[model samples]
Target: MNKRFALLLLVLLPLMACNKQETPAPAATPAAAENAAPAANEPVPADEPAASGETPAPAASAQTPAPEAAPADADAAAAAPPAASGALTPGTDYVEIPNGQPYLPLNGKVEVVEVFGYVCPACAQFQPLVNSWEKKLPANVRFTYVPAAFGGPWITYAKAYYASETLGLVERTHNDLFKAIHIDQTLKGERGQDSVADVAAFYGKYGVDPKQFASTMESFAVNAKLSKAKQWAIRSGLEGTPTIIVNGKYRVLGKTFPDMLRIADALIAQESARPAP
Candidate 1:
């Protein structure tokens, strides 16, 4: 039984995160493509998968795959899930982020930032779990999503995210956008090139004017946010999507998806226990 369990782990371990590589240059865009910078390569977790669509590494045959189709009600999969619980060992479960700081000012709350990319299949798989987890966070804990600025479709998606947030449409379109890219095949994520107009049209289904959406994707405001996101990823020492940083101090290194959240829960508790400054 122990050997069986170990074998199972060997099979599943590599699918936990999307590996970062030398990002391909951004494809031409109708707007602001020139502003998109190539993401710098950083060290990924030893077990992370290779670039999207490539064959899996020799040791692990199954890489992160697009998430299974969500039910008609997307929230149904995440509704009222049990809280994650586990004890954490410093070097085993997580490591401190070197020179790390919160992506935003803490004010009075504990900040949990997820560094993720829309084109990342692992992020798509982790979405439902995080969706439920974020919903249950206490008022004093703030959850923020900072999109990874890995180039190609990654930059395009990051721009779309900032534009949606600016337009007050993120709350409505977040989950569906994941579905569109991974499940419905309506949007090309990492598989093919995407333009500003292509992403704008996806948001159009949610009632925003496509032209305005495309323009906002290139707006100075959105560009500023994208730059900030890129800086945050670098500062966090992020090398892959679906990374959880707790209070900008600890970078989770769990052995499984649930284990990642469990360590994060313990770290959040630890941060909350810290005496006020």
Candidate 2:
């Protein structure tokens, strides 16, 4: 009986040892449990959002429509593949003004100056387009018109513009003057034909006192504006009428009229990112 009991005890003890080897033991301490936890630290890509967090905002596109060469070039532009999104090329698309001229913004707003001439057929063509574009411009931008005073009858036109401004008749006669010269062809812009009297007479029809118009054209204030416009034109490095200067820093250049506005739009976007001067 003793021999049988000993044999059973040996077999049972061996089975208990095997069971203990198969089972897992609890961690000895809290620190050991933490050390056993899995961990990972991955970096987020610059162009991609993080793996676990609030979604990031969409990035601005880097590509823009290339400048159109001419009205007929529209088809060619449409056919070309889009250029990669990036900053605009300097000297090719736009030339930076040599000296960073201080901008005299109105009401603390960024200024966009249009150097145009009344006698310029191109300016006349750009008028309606710009007029519409300016209306839709953000309130933070101030659109200013500076009539080019290039020799010939343009000087007289510039004086006429300032006179209208002085007499508070510019808003009423601005488009009228353009129509009078372009469509109506009644207000001639000849070398000597469109005299100061003729220009003042044109404003007379707009309810401006002819005497006031004539005298205001020669006022010191009018002369100052004309002189300032001449300086602006020269400093802008304009080879033609209808040149646009943004914040007095960049001279916008584009192949088509619409492209000109597009370039301006891009420049405004860049300006919006800058800290206030």
Candidate 3:
């Protein structure tokens, strides 16, 4: 009976120890699972939205076209294809001469001269376009116009140009008058006193004193310019109006003023490189 009681007590003690060990393992398993779950499902921080707000805005660089683009476009176009070796080629109605050098002086101290008449349609076309080129022109270069008095009617136009010069309205009314007559078809008069009066009225409309304008047109100072222009016209091979002489040498016809400028530009570049005066 004593042996039986002792055997039962030993068995119970061993079983109790095993049960205690098993209970600790089950408790440890639930704690480990809780720690692992947080890593995969991490909480979004409260400052995430604020941090995104701190990022910079996308940039905008250019807005409008550069002011130099128009002239630059002209420069690119002025890169004219080289002319074929020539001496009176057939099928080519050539304005440039066989023996003559390119009109624009592409050397140092280039000079530009305008041979024009106010009533001339072609000269009127060239005034504004040439004026633009004048703005970008170098200081070393000089520009002059031969307001040729080839005829009685042409004398009035030359005098008008001289009047505008004295009044400082060349830029404002130079192109405007051209368009007024040619494009808009405004100026109308016979080649006489009526025509002179009409043109003076046009100047007056732009705020020039009509009396002063008329007075200057008849002045000795204006007459001198008209006389010199007539002399240049005889010497410059100018058949008609709107001939632009570059550097006192090459002459370009101003049929289309912009095209005239292009030819003039080419000649001017060449003139700019010559020995200084």
Candidate 4:
């Protein structure tokens, strides 16, 4: 394996040994695009929310009822002792996050969609690690990427994603997408900081049409998919990037990733045995 690949594996393997609680994050809005300069060097989001969607709020943000009328599951978990039981049952514990303004879920698939941007350095580091994890995914699982368009240069990278997926160049050229932007710094917001055609054309060398790709990047179809992805991320109670959601309800966040796959597996197994809705 190349040194970078090895380093990435080493970094991700330890994640299995730890798990992060899926704490709720602030509501996603275009105001917080990945590359947007924060006020006075403040922190920023690793992935930006898509333009045309609104994700569901997390459980922590759920409507609170009177203490006397507490929800059954909440009371049960709180009253039960930890040594004898676990917290929250699948399905009963959480609800589905709707896809924003657009796409709906594909039937009979366990989605593992990732929300990422080519220009984010943290996203660059996450690429190889998630790719390795994908290779070992179960037959019932499905994986997809939500290319975000929060900033001007970001939309260009988003176009590259659509073109690559359309032309079957994703697996071969995916990693390079990030490297070309972050490592080599070749992308300088082409077309006067508003157009992504130059980079989309670069993917065209691998057989993608820059114009058609641009249209799809802004298409209703892509918009719906982006919306759903945001919903999935939000319902998963994501605190940051690199979160994974199983089905529309069960989510893995924080130090979750591959390691949290174990808990995800447990939840999936249990859900599989339950009666269908």
| Per-candidate TM-score against the hidden true structure | 0.71, 0.67, 0.56, 0.55
lDDT string for model 1 (66-173, tens) is 454665675876785553455565566677887788989999899998888777766775677788778888888999998877666778998999999999999999
Model 4: lDDT of residue 254: 24
Decoy 3 TM-score against native = 0.56
**How far does residue 259 in candidate 3 sit from its true spot (Å)?**
4.9
Candidate 1 stretches with Cα past 4 Å from truth are 1-17, 20-86
For candidate 3, the clash count comes to 17
Candidates in descending TM-score order: 1, 2, 3, 4
Order by lDDT, highest first? 1, 2, 3, 4
Judge candidate 3 at residue 92 and give its lDDT.
18
Task: Give every collision pair in model 1.
Answer: none
Write down the worst ten-residue block by lDDT for model 4. Answer: 13-22
Q: RMSD for each model, in Å, please?
A: 16.0, 35.9, 41.5, 13.6
Local lDDT at 93 for model 2:
49
Q: Which candidate is the best by TM-score?
A: 1
Model 4 Cα lDDT, one tens digit per residue, 166-193:
6678887887666655556555432134
Q: Higher lDDT: candidate 2 or 3?
A: 2
Give residue 188's error in model 3 in angstroms.
2.0
Per-residue lDDT, model 1, residue 5, is 55
**lDDT, candidates in the order shown:** 0.69, 0.62, 0.51, 0.49
- Candidate 1 residue 193 C-alpha distance from true site, Å: 0.7
